[model samples]
Target: MLVIGLTGDVGGGKSSVALLWEKEGAHIVDADKIVRELWREPEIIEAAVTRWGSVILDSDGSVRPQVIARLAFSDVREYRWLCDLIHPKVMRRMERAVFASNRWVVAEIPLLFEVGVPWWVDFVVYVTAPPDERLARLSSARGWGEEELRGREAYLLPREEKIRSSHWVIENDGTPEELRAKAAELAEMFSFFSEPIEVTVSCGSEEEARRLSKAVIDRRKAACVHVYPIESLYWWKGNVEEDHEWEVSFKTVLPLYPDLVGIISKEHSYEVPVINMASVVKANRDALLWLWEELSGEPDNHAHRS
Candidate 1:
């Protein structure tokens, strides 16, 4: 699965982008929501009460997050203490959510740069908008004035630094539809890596393996193919079969698996070739980009099979 660390400036529409990804079938792991749920735990509430007294609790004995936020944000030492207390627990839950998800996972962490991106995150996407736009959004949505917005933002890393550190940066000063379209496009690109597969086929000889590899690449059925010699042992014709064979591995996406299989079946010297496919759960981003680019074009139907 692909795990994206989604973060942005205050009121930059990071949640909007996450929601758009959710609509595209990506699972969302929201850090703020996790924090809210953690507040409901007796242990967490007890800890908060122990630190700040019962003043941090509501009349009903529930933790008041806004009260804690005001206290923590007012003093640097208090903020660090609060983060130290809550971040570990929040990270644990985030890890569990990401591990349990089979689909693409988008983790909306407002303070991702501040707390450090998790090692499990495949990439980071930073969202941003104009200062005026952001202020307008916060004011209208949360009734936060400029002074309050600036106070919260002062604790975060500089916008330029965050943008420089990110793998992708999204500018979100447009209409909601436009932001949704951008999210959709990004989701599609991420799906390419999440659904890529490595297909292995055993050929009768080195020459056949080479030929099949060329055929697959020439037709754009696979981004690339590697051929190497291997010893095979398997049951065939109700008897143990042993042979020296060549293995061909094709790097391609799941959507093109059938086309790759078709090329192998039509070109392999063996009547019943050994064909196996495995999902590529992780890969280098640059390599995946190259592979995706190679396979992005239409198939070369004019090329003859040889």
Candidate 2:
């Protein structure tokens, strides 16, 4: 599986790139969603309330993010304490997310490096812009002053470190159209070198599975397909039993996922089927590049994205 981690400074246009990836049919796991979900962990929220006092709470009794950000994002000790509380949990979720993203998964994590999670990624794209540009963008978007911007900037790892650590860099000081074009270009380039995929599929004694799996792989619905015998343990009709089954796995470029799903549903034997895709965990670089070429859908297929 190719795991690409995307990160950028505030107002650096990371979302634009993620959106572009989505346009070409890539799955995106966003860290912002993770953090929002984390706020619902009562113990963690209670601990924060106790540490920072209750003004951080809203009328709905949820911890207000702005209030929490004010406390934890500015004061180093407070920020470190919050990080100590949240970073580990976030990382754990990130691990699950990466694994869940079968094939090429693009994760939009804003503070990916600041939280020090780069090692988990196969490729990292650090989005950046000049501080002045960042401040200008943020001020226009959030009505923040220079001091506020500096405070936000200071808490993050320096820009230089972020850029130095990345395999690719996206500078966001240009217009949205420029950003979109650049992002499209980079995504195409990355896809050009991605490995051709392989997949494993599992199915209940449904007669259509073998044919379906083979057809999907044969037609490039997914890059590769594997069928295996599976012994499943579960409860049916309030009784548990072990049942023999066939599992088919598919390795395919991300773009073909929708079609893959359609085929599995249309052909699988089970009335209610299991058709979940898993991200590729690790793969040979040569295979990856080949996959990339097909995924990019370059005009000539022989031509490189660049």
Candidate 3:
């Protein structure tokens, strides 16, 4: 399973990117949504009323988030107090979501670095756009005045700092279609495993191994393939057997697994060829980006995948 932390500045389209990943079978754990549910808890509303003296309540006796935000962000001490009261519980929920399944998961935590989310996240994806573009989007879509936008922006870390800490960057300065393309790439980048899969196939001779490996790379199904000599020992027809064989390993994405297997099965010289896969688990970001470029027929940026 891969756990990716998705975050960005205000109006940078973090939700849009998250939606794309969700469409690709990634479970989205939205931190803002979790906090919204917490607001409706009776105990939480009661606590807010008790501490803030009913100023943060509504006519129907519910907590008013707008009122609370105005109060909390106005004073450093008040903000810390509010965070202390709710962050621990919210973090617990976030942790549960990360470990809930053995599939790709994307957690949209707007304050990922500020709140110090778990370090176990496989990688961080920071969405970005020009300041002017973000400001325009906030004004038109969110109806936020310049002053309001500045107020929110002042609370977050600088864009350069966020980019420095991120493992991947997604630029959201273009049209929705362009952003969707980036989102789809991101979804594929983190699906199933953060690093590429190492698929190994045993063959009767080096000729067969080399041929299969060349075919995979030529078809753009893998970034690279290696063939090596090896000895195999396994039970067959109720008898243990030992034989010299060649192993070919291909580095590729999970979505291409079925295709790689099919090709190897068709090209093998044995009745039942041995094929298996192993996860890379972790690797250099540049290396992964290089692999993606090779597989996608993109020009080599080498430094970044975006």
Candidate 4:
């Protein structure tokens, strides 16, 4: 089965791209939709009422997301606590879909890497939109105050990190047509079955971050996708504190790292945002190489790599 994970920051228009893929006839397993189902579970409501108290629940004993979103986003630990409660449930649902997919399947996994479930997918695709665009989009939609906006932003993995680790970057900053064009390219390529490569990609552009990721995976060079935020730390001339700018980490393969790095650097955002690299410390045998080859556009045999 061709299981692909899709992720993007808030307001990145990932759903828009997913629709384009749907038009092309891929089955979609939506993570957010599954999580929404969990929201209706009595256990979930009980947990919320216990933590945030009974007021968050409606008169009928249902959880009101807006209430929870406000309370949860107000604190990182609380938000994480909520994620801990819901993520596993979401995973179980995703697992069911993955097993059931007889043909190409697209799973809308907002936290694929964070939850560490991308390991099951043949590929991962991250949607990309500029941070300003994201902020603007959110603002226009909700008419939020600074505090509300910041709270929402705090819930997301840094965009820079998600973009850096992706295998395919669907730029959502453009018109729907532009995004659809990118999605089509991905659908065309994933039809291959030569196995994948494992490689780390330090990419600047969301497009490049994923392009290299898919390329390396398709090439069968490396396995496992590690994405983390790399903040540029600098001290103002006389300030004791250092300012943090963003960078991303991609852990893939030693052999294909150089080529991927070049492409990432060329496509990167910062004049010198680090396109960092690292080897996979541990991974499943065939799956590891399958990742790198799949991303690198040079699908190879997974058995030989092992």
Candidate 5:
């Protein structure tokens, strides 16, 4: 799965972008939701009471996030202490959610860069809007004035640095439809390259390997086929056998696996060819995009033998 780190300045509409991706079938690991859940735990509540007293609790006996925010944001030392208490737990939960998901995952972490990018994230997307627009959003959404917004943002990494570290930067100054379009485009691209696989087939000879590779490419069964010489040893018919062979590896997505196997089986001379598939956990974006483009056309809608 492709894991994306989605972050942005306060009131920049990162959550809106995440929702769009979710609509496109991506799983959203929302950090704020996780934080709220953590805060509701008994141990966390007890710890909060110890640190800041019972005044942080609501009438319903739940921890008031706004109360904690107010107290923490007012003092740099208090803010750091609060983060120290909360961020590690949040990181663990976020990693668990991201790693457990099979679908394309979008992690909506507002302080992603501040806490450091997670190792599992494949890419980072930084959302931003014009200062005036962001200030307006903060005012309308959180009852925060310009000074308050600026004060809170002071604790974050600079906007320019965040943008520089990101793989994709989205400007949320446009209409919601425009922002949604950007999210949709990214979702599609990520989904297309999500499950890359490397199919390795052993051929009896270089000539056979070349022929099979050519057929696969011509039919668009795979994005690319690499042919190389190798020595092999195997047990066949109760005897050990050794031979010089050619290895052909196909770079393609999992959806095209059946087609690739069919082409190899049909064109190969070996009765029981060595066909092995390995999942590619990571790949270069440009190369994967090229692979996707090469095999973008519809697959053959026909049956194939084992």
Candidate 6:
């Protein structure tokens, strides 16, 4: 199971990214929702009353989040007190929810890094958007003033540090379609929608096939390459042609298919290499592991995308 902690600046579209993950079958545990529940808890209400007296409470005697925020943000000690009072309860609920989730769990923790909860996830995905855009979104969506937004944002770590700390970064400063595409790409890493690829690349001769096979395997492009002698019939230019050929089948992960195809084309003698690939819907776990381990040697610059 893969546990991904999703976080971002307030109003940076982390929830939008999380919705895409949810569509891909990820069990989403929203920390904001947990906080909302915590706000109404008797213990939290009592704690707020004890700390700030009646001012932080509503006429109905419940703790008002906005009132608490207004008081807490003005003083560091008050802020810490509020966090200490609520964070433990939030963590307890988060743990219970996560324990009952599916194989792919995505917890949307807006203050994931602030609360130091990244350590609990397999990896953290930080969503990013321009400050102007984020401020606009927050103002329009939640009716927060610029000063109010800035005040809360000031409490968090720097944007650059958050991006650096996270294992993956998703930029949400684009259209919804672009964001969805990036979301899908990131989803592939968790193997939620991942499938094996069978790549076919033909060679002029058995020697050429063996050389191609060896090169790809040694380079960790393919876990297993099978070279077979075969007769190929094809239409070239204006005439149908038949000749002896060698077929090379590369068993690899879907993510490596494009690279594998490029490698085959670069090594092939033919001007137009017979490169084709199809997804393997069901494959043995050991075989999949071998392919993954081989491809793991490659540098993952795309792992922490912006």
Tell me, by lDDT, which candidate is best: 5
* C-alpha RMSD of candidate 3: 3.9
* Candidate 3, pairs of clashing residues: none
Best by TM-score: 1
lDDT of 1 by residue, 135-233 (tens): 998899888889999888887889888888888878887888888777777777776666678999988888888999999999887888888999989
Worst 10 residues of 1 by lDDT: 297-306
lDDT of each: 0.84, 0.73, 0.80, 0.65, 0.85, 0.79
Cα deviation of 142, candidate 1, in Å: 1.8
Arranged by TM-score, best first: 1, 5, 3, 2, 6, 4
Model 1 alpha-carbon drift over 4 Å, by segment: 298-306
Give the lowest summed-lDDT range of ten residues in model 6: 297-306
Off by over 4 Å in 6: 193-306
RMSD of each: 5.4, 8.9, 3.9, 19.9, 6.5, 11.4
Tell me which of candidates 2 and 6 scores higher on lDDT.
Answer: 6
Candidate 5's TM-score reads 0.84
- In candidate 3 the C-alpha lDDT for residue 64 amounts to 79
For model 2, the stretches where C-alpha displacement exceeds 4 angstroms are 192-195, 198-280, 284-306
* lDDT for residue 262 in candidate 2, whole number 0-100: 81
Model 4 CA lDDT for position 13: 83
Q: What does candidate 5's lDDT look like per residue over 15-40, in tens digits?
A: 99988988888899999999999998
For lDDT, candidate 2 versus 3, the one ahead is 3
